[model samples]
Target: MQIETGVSLKPYNTFGLPAVAQTLVRIEADADVRRVLGDATLGRAPKFVLGGGSNIVLTRDVSQLVLKVEVPGRRVVDERADAWIVEAGGGENWHDFVTWTLDQGLPGLENLALIPGTVGASPVQNIGAYGVELKDRFDTLDAVDLITGRSVRLDASMCRFGYRDSIFKQALAGKSLITRVRFRLPKPWQPVLGYLDLERKMAETGQHQPTARQVYDWICEIRRAKLPDWTVMGNAGSFFKNPVVTEDQCRDIIGRDPEIVHYPMPDGTYKLAAGWLIDACGWKGKSIGRAGVYEKQALVLINRGGAIGAEVVTLARAIQESVYGRFGIRLEPEPLVI
Candidate 1:
């Protein structure tokens, strides 16, 4: 409930970038929500919602109100024979939520293991990994309408999920604040290992149909091996989204670079692996000043110790130019830069 001015954001963000928020408010409860936003003295101002601070790039000091969503709780409101409906507060840490669900023997969320972010922001970006996305198990969500100053609950259909996107990031955009999320999880089990990493791990382990917990552990291992930890080394995960291209464009890209890995969509279009394209473009592991690309994964840009936000943005732009020039595909940044 404490509101501070010009607070140092080095601890809040994983990248360790020292960006300052003009006014930072941490709302611990639902009551605190209106109390902070309705303050007459603060007046109307630009604001950014910060969660676990993953999936974002703090490129510069934000001269606006930064409302750090901290409203937190959970409830096993409904239970069935096959699956259970578990609800979590918006401020609940994403990994903690996953761990708690796993301990409860809940299925479905095992594939989302170790993803660093807040539960409130999950639906906003429709976070995904391996072969699963949040939308796959989405039941419903409750959010506060920023304009109406009222709470609302939306179902899976209303979310309009698509390739790491949702109504929150599209139609709803910045007009609402997610207060709670409900997930329909299976009680029994079903481990999806269709992805290359899981499949490869299964082969190495000489086992098939591993338990949900096992899948979680394996995924955590795989992610740690490729993605750098933001605590020690600075990074915002994958910097660019995989470009979904037309069939002809895909062919043109593949014709020149046959080694380009692609995922074919059900809609007939193809998604070019952004990491492969960036790595192939000779930008992978390449550093300019302090900001540079991660060596293991080409899609991630790292802040090597003291990299400035402007420098990071510049490097990202450079990568975009490279990818666009090489494949005629414009790469889009995944981070919500403020």
Candidate 2:
């Protein structure tokens, strides 16, 4: 692979945060990764795998060797009696992949439409929206070990999927580079409309039974109304994970603030709406330096204009402290700050 030096990372990341990669290499295929690992100077260097740059906040210039994954391909790999197995190159746009699935008559991924980032980063973040998460449809993935230059495959059980997290975000953080991902979309498609926004859409449209394409359209419309277009305004979607608390904690919070928004989890826990908490703390439309909370949706942190990463971090920290001080719940940031 051709190693380029002094690459501007502003255009690479969704936040448009100012940062430079000292050395950057565009990995277009599995062989590219092996080529890098086989190199003398590059093989030994600490590396950072970058996908769509949609889920990160670049704080400073990167010292690690940045491998920008750009592998591209998508197709229905297999059709089983029970499900449709689809595979996509890690570099494929996640939203486009979802749309393609719908176009191909696959319907299970409709609920996750319009999500930013690449296919490779989806499992890394365990991305979820509406009533569906990546883990719900994941089949398998292929990754190349950074140290060994050998490719490996992992199933859902091995990925260790959790709320907005996976093994890729934990033990395998920078140890492996994902080259491809496969999804298992089950047959006899079912629409997930239990989410509040989807429910509201159904109420507005007066359609109790919606098709997969209908669900996809509704999700797109809902997200567009709530989240700013990152191309126009710099942002990394939701800024924090919806904090999950025990029943007692939820009861205590509800006792103090009856209007608090929360949903009971399957295991008897409660998932608190992070945006509601931030808005409740009076952070909506508030700015700290060049970074500010999106007035449309409090969960998003946006760059006002030419905002730096430090400003975003500062604003996020301030919001976190305010939320903790009032609700005693520490809001965890969703983006990787590097």
Candidate 3:
């Protein structure tokens, strides 16, 4: 395999932070991983797996070997009586794959439309939007062990999925490269319209029972209006995850700040709106160096033209500190920092 050195990662990551990979290799298939393991120098070196570059904040140049996963394929693998099973390569663009499923008459992925990232990265973070998460439709995934070069297939239970988390972010973090993922879209599709934005979309259109296509279109519209376009603004969408607090903790905060935005989880926990907390702390349209809180949505931290990774981290830290100081809830960032 040919190695590329001194590659600029600015265009690769959504944040557009300046960083360089000293050595990089494109893993187009599982064989590519095994090939690297068989190599002498590359095999012994630490490796960093990169996907669509959507959920990362590059803080410095990488000395470890960078495996840029580019494996590619997509198709309906099975049409069972209960569901249609779809599979896509890890390298495929996630949004495009979702659109493809819709085009093929599969309605399960409509809620996840327009989420930026590759298919391989989805399960790692359990990406979700508009009241639906990747875990809901996940069937199985094939991945290769980075060190052993052995391939393994994991079902949904083995993934240990949680709110924006999975085994890939825990026990197997940085230890494997996902090759492909399969999704099970159940028959008789149901629209997930519980989210406030989707409910508003329903109210506006007067379509209480929306088809999958309608839901997909509404989600895309809602995201476009709320989230900054990464191509234009250079931001990792939703800089912080919504913090889930216990019912008593939520009540305490609600009593102190009557207008605090929150939602009750089925598990009896309360998920506080991180954006609302940051906005309440007066972070919107504020900047620390070149990094700034997005004026339209406080949850997103943007690179205000030519910003460095450290500046973004600094701005995020300031937001966290302020939110914790005011609300006594520490905000956790969503993106992986490296």
Residue-wise lDDT of candidate 1 within 1-338, one digit each (tens)? 87999899888887777788988988676566667658775536666778888877787888867878887887787888977999998899988999898887776888888788899989988988888899878889887776556778899899999887888788887677788899988656677888888889999998797988899999899999999988889888878888899999889888899899998888999988999989888998898889999989998899898987778888999999998898888899888776
- Give the lDDT of residue 259 in candidate 2: 97
Q: lDDT by residue for model 2 over 1-338, one digit each (tens)?
A: 66899999999999999999999999989899999988889989999999999999998999999999988999999999989999999999999999999998898999999999999999999999998999999999999999898999999999999999999999998999999999999987878888889899999999899999999999999999999999999999999999999999999999999999999899999999999999999999999999999989999999999999999999999999999999999999999999
TM-scores of the candidates in the order shown: 0.95, 0.99, 0.99
Error of 1 at 66 (Å): 1.2
Give the residue spans of candidate 2 off by over 4 A.
none
Cα distance off (Å), candidate 2, residue 126: 0.4
Candidate number of the best lDDT: 2
Model 3 regions more than 4 Å off: none
Give the poorly placed runs of model 1, Cα more than 4 Å off: none
Q: What overall lDDT goes with each candidate model? A: 0.84, 0.95, 0.94
How do the residues 1-338 of candidate 3 rate in per-residue lDDT, one tens digit apiece?
46799999898999999999998999999999999989999999999999989999999999999999899999999999999999999999999999999999999999999999999999999999878999999999999999899999999999999999999999999999999999999998888889888888889999999999999999999889889999998998998999999999999999999999999999999999999999999999999999999998999999889999999999999999999999899988999999
State the lDDT at 228 in candidate 3: 92
Give the higher-TM-score candidate: 1 or 2: 2
* Every candidate's CA RMSD: 1.6, 0.7, 0.8
